[model samples]
Every structure is written in structure tokens, then in C-alpha cells.
Target: MRIYAHRGASKDAPENTLKAFCLAFSQHADGIEFDVYQHENGIIVFHDRTLRRRANAEGYLLETPWSTLQTLDIGDGERIPTLNETLGVVPTNKWCNIEIKHLVDVKRWVNDVKAALSQSQIAIEHVLVSSFNHHWLKAITDLWPEVKIGALSASYELDCTASAKALNAYSVNIALDAVDKTFVQTVLSEGFNVYVYTVDEPKDMEMLAQWGVTGIFTNVPELAKRVMAKRASAKDAVSDKS
Candidate 1:
């Protein structure tokens, strides 16, 4: 299974900050995932609707301009990074998952993402656009059919695989709590990838891997890499004995 750093090794650095992203790559994560919100001037990498949570400041992110937002430290002297600025940290060999944190101008954001990828000389196919808003995901697909889309969900009420097929999604990201063998099997059987979000525990990671999950979004990519390595070593030993 591929390991995607959830908001970029978030446990080590401020979530969604450049520091976290750099740390994720340094930790040898297969990919990096970050949230993006469209601002008046440009797109910014952040998670919450307001700055109160991470920035320790009081203001709605949408209401604040880029000039002011960039100055406010989210944590540990880390400032909010623009989408392009964040893209600069990603290597060409790795993938990037960009989650739309809020429902904003879909067209503008899609175009902006494309431009950023182009400017960075990154392959468009290596990027996956994900959002809780199915409409926004669909809009992204409509605009850039080649780009992969991921349907984000926190509940099992909907048949995730069916929804993924309907959206032409490359994958579906569900909360780790909602995952089970049946759900994983059903999604995989439908020919779409299944990615579990925010999985950090070793046991849960092993369980998800045993169930054939396509990828995992975790706050600690280094830990995931270690666990995967150990698992691989154990399997090799068993094979050698056999």
C-alpha cells in the first residue's frame, strides 16, 4: 500500500505548512496530501475554515487577504503557503493529493491547480483531486478528464464504490473507522482504489494492508514505512523457511 503523508507529516510539523511537507518528503513518504482553499488573490494550503484552530488568530480565512494571511503564523513560525509554493516542495517522482477544504469557486481552483502543475513541470496525471463535495470533484473531472479524482466520505451510508464509478473516480477515501473487510473488498471488486484516511496506528495499518487497501493517509509516514518494512521482512522470512 502507498503511504501518503496526511497534511505532510502533520504530527511532526504544523499541519499544512511547508515545514510539514518538507518533513514528509524527508521521511520517504510515497506521496504527500494537503488541503487547499481558494483565496481572493490565490489558493492557500490550509485545513480549517477559520484561522482559530491552527493559526491561533481570529479571522475567517476567506475574509482575509493573502498579504495578511501570509504574515500570520500557523505554528512554530510557519506561515501559510500558497498552492504553488507548496507544489515546489514535491518531487517529480512522487504523487500529490490536493483536497479542497471548502466549497468555493470550483472552476477557478481547477484552473489554478493546472497552472501550478504546469509551472512546476509536474505531471498532471500524478495529482489526484479529492473533496467531500461530490459536485466539486465532478467539476474537476469535467474540466480535466485526465486528472484523477477521489471521492471523500466520512460515512458508509452511500455505496462508495458506486459513487466512485459514477464520478469516474480513481479512488475513494473513507474514514479509517468506517473500513472493514467487506467494505474494502466491495470497493476493490468494483475496480476502484480504496484509501483510508488518518491511519496512524501500527495494528490498524497492518489490518488495512491485509485487507488490500490501495493507500493510507497517515500523520506519520516514517512510522508507516517502518511497519511496512517489517511486514515485508517477516513475509520474506516465512517464504525462505517454507
Candidate 2:
């Protein structure tokens, strides 16, 4: 299974900051995942709607201007990064997952993401835009049909994966709590890739790998890599003994 750093190596650096992203790549994560919100005039890479948890500041993120927001220290002296700034650090060959936390203009964000990718020279096929708001994803697909999309969900739907099917999603990005052996089998059976989020526990990682999950999002990408490597070695040893 591929390991995507959840908001970068967030366990080590400020979530969604450039430091975290660079660190994630250095740690050899398969990809990096970060949240973006269309701010006052630009898209900023940040995870929370409020600054309390990340910045230790006041007021909602939407109400704050970029000038003020940019000055606030998130952690380890890491300033909030713009979409372009974040994209600038991504390796051309690694995967990129950009989750739309909120956006008012789908077209603008799409253009921004496109321009950023072009500037970074990252392959369009290597990127996946995910969101719980399937309508926004639908809008994205309508605007850029070639753009890959990942359908995000916190609940296990009765339809199994109608949301993903509707958008022809590249992957089904789901909450860790919502996935199980049966759910994995069901989604895989339907031919959609399954990616679980915020999986930091080794046991959970092992279980998800055993269930054939395409990837996992975790705060500790280094640990996730170690666990997967160890699992692979054990499987090889068993095969040799057999």
C-alpha cells in the first residue's frame, strides 16, 4: 500500500506548512496530502477552519485576510503556504493529493491548481483532487474532464460507492473508522481504489494492507513505511519457509 503523509509529516512539523511537506518527501512518503481553502483572494494550504489549533490565534479563517493570516506562525515558525508555494515543493514523480476543504469558485481554484502543476511541472495524472462535496468534484470534472478526482466520505453508504461512481473517481478516500474488510472488498469489487485517512497505528496499517487498500494517509509516514516494509519481509520469509 502507498503511504501518503497526512498534511505532510504533520507529526513532525506544522500541518499543511511547507516544512511538513518537504519533510514528508525527505522521509520517502509515496505522496503528500494537504487541505486547501479558497481564502479572501487566494487559495491557502491549511487544515482547520479556525486558527486555534494550528496557529494559536483568534477568529475564523474565512474572516481573516491573507496579510494577517500569513503573519501568524502556525508552528516551528512555519507560515501558512499558498497553493503554489506548497506545490512548488512536490517532487515531479511522487503522487499529490489536494483535498478541497472549501471553495467558492471552482473555476478559479481549478485554474490555480492547473497553473501550479504546470509551474511545478508535475504530471496531471499523478494528482488527485478530493472532497466530501461531490458537487464541487462534479464541477471540477465538468471544467477539466481529464482531471482525476477522489470521492471523500466519512460514512459507509448503502450504495457502497455511488458517489465515486457518479464522478468516475480515481479513488474512494474514506475515513479510517468507516472502512473494514467487507467495505474494502466491496469497494475493490466495484473497481474503485480505497484510501483510508489518518491511520497512524501500526496494527491498523497492517490490517489495511492485508485488506488490499490502495493507500493510507498517516501523520507518521516514516513509521508507516517501516511497518509496510516489515510486513513485506515477513510475508517473504513465510513464502521461503513454505
Candidate 3:
């Protein structure tokens, strides 16, 4: 299974900062996942409706202007990064998962992403656009038909991966609590890649690998890399014995 840096090695640096993203690649993570919110100025890398958690400020991201939002410190003296800046940091060979946290205009969102990706070395196939609001994903697919999409779900729906099927998504980005071996098998049988979120424990990582998960979004990329490396070595040893 692949390992993605959840909010760019967020456990080490501030979530969604360029510093964290750079660190994730240095840690040899397969991909980086981060949230984006579109504002009057442009698209920005950030998470949460409020700035209280990340910036220790008193304002909602939607209510604040980009000019003001840009001035606040995210962490380690790092300011919030633009979508283009974030994309530029990702190597062409690496992967990126851009989770749409807030978007006011669908067309503007597509246009902005187009511009950013055009400048970055990363290919469209290497980018997985995901959002909990399936409507946004549907609209995005209509505008950019070839762009890969991932369906984000926090709940264990009765339909398993109906949302992903609805969008013809590249993968199903699911919460850790809602996943299990049976569920993974069910989704895999339906031909959808299953990628779990925010998995930081080595035991959970090993279990998911056993269940044949596609990938995991983790806060600690270095630790995930270590766990996966050990798993690979074990598999190689077994293969040699056979």
C-alpha cells in the first residue's frame, strides 16, 4: 500500500504549510494530501472553518479576506501557501491529493486548478481531487473529464462506495473508523481503490496492508514509511522461502 502525508507531515510542522510538504517528500512519502479553500484572492492551502486551531486567531476563514488571512502565521513562522506554490513543491514523480475544503464557484475552482497544474511538473493523473461534497466533485468531473477524483466520506454508508461510483472516482477516501477488512474487500471487488485517512498507528498500518488497502493518509510519514518498509521486507523474505 502507498502512504500519503496527511496535510503534509502535519505532526512535525503546521498543517498545510509548504515546510511540512517539503519534509514529507524528504521522508519518502508516496504522496501528500492537503485541504484547499478558495477565497476572494485565490486558492489557499489550509484546513478548518476557523483559524483558531492553526493560527490562534479569532475569525472564520470564509468571513476573512485573503489579504488578512495571508498575514496570520500558520506555524514555525510559516504563512499559508497558495495552491500554485504548494503544487510547485511536489515533484513530478510524486503524487498529490487536493481535498476541496471550501469552494464558492465550481468553474473558478477548475480554472484555478488548471492554471496551477499547467505550471507544475506533476501530471493530472498524479493528482487526486477529493471532497466530501460529492456535488463539487461531480461538477469538477464535468468541467475536467479526465481529471482523477477521489470521493471523501466520513461515514460508513449502507451503500459502501456508492458516492465513489456516482462520481466514477479514482479512489474512495474514507475515514479510518469506517473501514474494515470486509469493507475493503467489498469496495475492491467493485473496482474502487480504497485509501484511508489520518492513520498514524503502526498496528493499524500493518492491519490495513494485510487487508490489501490501496493507501493511507497519515500525519507521520516517516513512521508510515518505516512500517511499510518492514512489511515489504517480511513479504520479500516469505517470497524467498517459497
Candidate 4:
């Protein structure tokens, strides 16, 4: 299973900052996952409806211009990065999962995201676009059909698999709490990749791997890497016996 850092090794550094992202890569994560929002200045990397929780600032990201938002230091002297800057951090071999956190405008966001990806000069396949707003994903599909998209759902009732198919999503990014053997099998049987989010526990990671999850989003990339290494070694030993 591939391991993606949730907001870039968020457990170690401030979430969604360049430091966190660089730390994620150093910690051996296969990919980096971060949230993005389109504002007047540009597409900026951030999560949450407001900046209060992480940045200790008071303002709606949607209403705030990038200049004003960028001035607020998230942590360790890291300002919020633009989508272009964030994309620059991803190596060609690694994947970048950009989650659309808010929809100021679906069409406009898709255009800006596409532009940023184009500017990054990375292989288009290396980036996976995901969003809880299926509508926005659908718009992305219509506009940038070649880009891989994932349908994100925290609720099992949302029928992520079906919705993913409808949106032409390459994968379904579901909440870890809703994942199980049955759920993973159900989605896999439909020929869609399954990726669960924010997994931090070793037992849970092992279980998800056993359930055939394609990837996991985690806060502790180093820990997940260590756990996966052990899992791989154990599997190899079993195979050798066979």
C-alpha cells in the first residue's frame, strides 16, 4: 500500500506548511496530500473554513485575498504556500494529492488547478485531484478529463464507489472509520482504487493493508513507513516458506 502524508507529516510540523511537506518526504511518504482553495490572488494551500484554528488568524479564506492570508505565519515562519509553490515540492517520482477544500467557483477552481499543474511541469498522472464536493469533481472531470480524480466521503451513506464512478474518479478516498474488509471489497469489486484518510495507528494501518486498501493518508509518515516495512518483511518471510 502507498502512504500519503496527511497535510504533509502534520503530526510533526505545522499542517499545510512547506516545513511539514518537506518533512513528509524525508520521513519516507510516497506522496504528499494537502488542501487547496482558490482566492482572488491565486490558488493557495490551506485547510478549514477559517484560519483561526491553525494560523491563529481570523478571516474566511474565501473572502480574504492571498496577500492578506499569506502574511499570517502558520508555524516555524512558514507562510501559506500557493498551489504553484506546493507543486514545486513534489518530485517527479512521487504523487501529489490536492484536495479541494472549498468551492468559490467550480469552473474557476478547475481552471486554476489545471494551470498550476501545467506550470509545475510534472507528469499529469502523478497528481490526483480529490474533493468532498462531488459536484466540483464532476466539473473537473468535464474540464480536465485526463487528470485523475478521487471522490472523498466521510459517510458510508454517500456511496463513494458509485459517486466515484459517476465522477470518473480514479479512486475513492474514504474516511478510515468507515473502512472494513467488506467495504474495501465492495469498492474494489467495482474496479475502483480505495484510499482511506488520516490513519495513524499501526493496527489500523495493518488492518487496512490486509483489507487491500490501495493507499492510506496519515499524519505520521515515518511511523507508517516503519510499520509498512515490517509488514513487507513479514509477508516476504511467509512467501519464502511457501
lDDT of 3 by residue, 38-64 (tens): 987899988889999999999898889
In terms of lDDT, the poorest run of 10 residues in model 3 is: 61-70
Mind giving the per-residue lDDT tens digits that candidate 2 earns over 48-91?
A: 89999989998999999889998999999999999999889999
Give the residue spans of candidate 1 off by over 4 A.
none
Candidate 2 residue pairs in backbone clash: none
Scored by CA lDDT, what does every candidate get?
Answer: 0.89, 0.92, 0.93, 0.87
Model 4 error, position 121 (Å): 4.8
Q: What is the lDDT, from 0 to 100, of the residue 144 in candidate 2?
A: 94
- Per-prediction RMSD in angstroms? 1.1, 1.1, 1.0, 1.5
Clashes of each: 0, 0, 0, 0
Candidate 1 colliding pairs: none
Q: Compared with the true structure, what per-residue lDDT tens digits does model 4 show for residues 1-242?
A: 99999999999999998889889999989999999877777788999888898789887878787668878888888999998888888776888899987676777877777787777747888889999888888888898799899989987854647898799789989998877788899899999999999899999999999999999999999999999999999999999999
